[model samples]
Target: MSAPLLQIDDLSVTYWDRSLLGLRANGFEAVKRATLTVDAGQTLGLVGESGSGKSSIANALLGLVPPSGGTINFDGQDLATLRKGFPPEIRQKIQAVFQDPYSSLNPSMTVEEIVTEPLKVHTRMTRVERHEKAVELLKLVKLPETHLHRYPNEFSGGQRQRIAIATALALQPSLIVLDEPVSALDVSTQNQIINLLYERRDALGISYLLIAHDLALVHHISDRIAVMYLGHIVEEGPADRVYHQPAHPYTQALLEAVPLLDPARQRARRAERRGRVTTDMPRLSEKGCPFSGRCPHVMDRCTARMPPAFTVPDGGTARCFLLDDEPNEQGRSKD
Candidate 1:
């Protein structure tokens, strides 16, 4: 069988903090040994709170930032080995659509220019061909060909995002890093953009690393969903499984944070949560489970060391000791 389109193994991204004197004080591991894969023609939704390393992973994949450790293998090449940065050909095979459509696009350039920029740089396509291809891309994103002549300022937030997506697709990339691509739009517009992306991905056979903070919204278009917290991938599984049967306490908390429609049930759930949550969330720790401080299922062992990624039956892996029921290195059961 063919390998997955993209595979990330034990990837870690670190940023150094400067002291008052301008010397490097400490290194913060934004992403800690996170591993996941994006199959060809499928979407893997990466859901996490702000500063949970979602964008860090996206940046590493895009070659915008250097990874402090581990390897990123895309289509069989180790991107981490490219010290100078991705070559032109590799860059053409991977593209990105970021949040804030207003700032991501070049306002000075026309839609035609924005959509065809990749082609001009990476391909031998002539001006006429590029123009025709740009129009075709606009149609793929459900934009009118006439809109291509307009600037980003002339379009709504959703329309501008569509243009950005069209630009990302111009290269026909194997993998596209969608970093909060629709979070800026209205609910209806968000659904429209998500549906458009889903359709185009299936039709064109492209893979997506979709980064968002909304699990429910992500579950709508993703085949798999990964939940992150405090630089650790706490839980990941099939979209349905992870959303419906969250294994980690953090995952359950995230799902519960989504407001329910029924006021009575919402109130009841909130009360239950209030009863369980006793302390404030903890900061990142060098050792031990990242979620241990606030985990409802926290155990003594949780604070002793980092939890291993245990296999969740009928689902994906999770970094929680609750699932570690087997004998330990000392030959005694954890339970």
Candidate 2:
């Protein structure tokens, strides 16, 4: 009955367009009316293609970018009010782990410094206390105390990411924005990091705003999954339901893009896709639905008006009209 740990309501992020004269004109909205919630100890996986504005949401949540509209309430505090980065009080409650571990950590700082930096900045812990905590943190991340003095360059890509995760956890933040946390690593390393993250999330009781491009990968760790197309959240629901039965065409395409392990099924999927229509939809038709131009199930009405989020019968919601029940006016969900 308590409010969710984090709630984003109709959040929008826009960058102004400039003419040849360099004056601000109509802006390009990178995120549009994005509404989502992450309960305490829950993982919300946000998946989308490149430029789909998943990172924009992360940036806005981190206070890196000021949102153009809507509100971001965290632990009952409105974070959207802070135009610049949130103050130390709010910063200590939220943290981030970026995509590339190789570049995210400062090569200059040792593992101890990197891991306990948050403590130094945010707490009154003494040198010995910070050192002891850093050692414990290294252990928490599955690394030994011997590596505390080593630089980031000494560790492998996966190890550096582990250190980064440790740093994000040092403050014991309620929310962590993991922006493609494992994408830069190899398949084996990626799985290792993901498993580690899953273990840590359970042990620490932390909530995560996990952003990634792979729906299959996100489904593995997310309690709920939200799919973004361009800037709109096309579909969202429980992980199993959204992964097995996608409600939006864009979500279906994302799932279909994942390679099947069975060779025959992979070949058959390719063949089926090749047989489908490849004609390009008109550019002007993008005014209504963001995905209208590319949607196979797009209707004439789709080109005239944007679709609202219609509740799926099982769970979650999708901004697609195909699920609408013409016979029952009350079937539509207001969620």
Candidate 3:
């Protein structure tokens, strides 16, 4: 096996609340020692609820926010050490597509200018060459040459997203961090954008760290999936295994929450969920399992100590005490 394109080990990101006196009063860990990897030319879908630190991880990866601890190795370079301006070479190789297309692109800039901005910054391409490349990128995203002169406001939400994607591809980066790229679009448009991204990734041989709250949406495009809850990765494995046979309770609940197309199945799942006890937001525990309070299968041992990452039968790991009976080889602590 080759080295992963992006390797994140024990990554932690924290935000400090300041007092009026200019002192740090409290700190919140948005990401808690999270570890995951994205292999070359593979999409790693990171799924979690809002405030579960999905965007935090994305921001950290893009260098918009610094990690409080741990190492982020992107193609063998340490991201932590690049605190000063991120090296132009490194920056060029890692691009980003944000969620809100309207906000991500500048209204003043035409599609041609927006898409070719990266080329101008990263390469010594002439204006004519940049324009030609921009046209090609627009075509790659299924937009026409006529759309090049138009502003972002003139295009629909989906078209704007395509423009954003084209801009990201301008430099032919190795990895593209997509932070909820299609969450803002309508259902049909979302599918189109997802399909476009899937096609582009396969054709370009690029890796993606796709962050989204919907497991069903990302499962289609991702080669692997990781589930995050309250900042910790509770489960991770192949996309099919994680989607079809989720080993973690949170993952199961998330899957169950996705409305099924069949009326009967949807009703049945809804009724089943109602039968289970629903509680208020759980208080963060320092020692024991962070999910124990809301977990239906919570055991005494669950509250006593944090469970290790148990190897699931489907070739993945789940952080749950129910697997404690399994052999040591079948389970190991990430900590």
lDDT of each: 0.89, 0.89, 0.89
- Return the clash pairs for model 3, or none: none
Candidates in order: C-alpha RMSD to true structure: 2.4, 2.1, 1.7
Off by over 4 Å in 3: 326-331
Q: What value of lDDT does candidate 3 attain over all alpha carbons? A: 0.89
Task: Please give, for residues 1-335, the per-residue lDDT of candidate 3 as tens digits.
Answer: 88999999889999999999999879999999888999999999999988899999988888888899989999889896677757888899999998998799999999899999888888999999998898899899999899999999999999999999999999999999999999999999999999999999999999999999889999999999999999999999999999999999889889987889999988887787795945757757877788888888877777877777887887778888776664344335555
| Estimated TM-score for each candidate | 0.95, 0.95, 0.96
Candidate 2: regions farther than 4 A off: 17-23, 277-286, 327-335
Clashing pairs in 2: none
Candidate numbers sorted by TM-score from highest down = 3, 1, 2
Give the per-residue lDDT digits (tens) of candidate 2, residues 1-335: 99999999999999888989999899988999899999999999999989889999999999988899999999778888878567887899899999999999999999999999999999999999999999989888899999999999999999999999999999999889999999999999999999999999999999999999888899999999999988888898999999999999889888988989999999989888885634564344445777878878878777876677898888999988788877235346454
Clashes per model (N, Cα, C within 3 A): 0, 0, 0
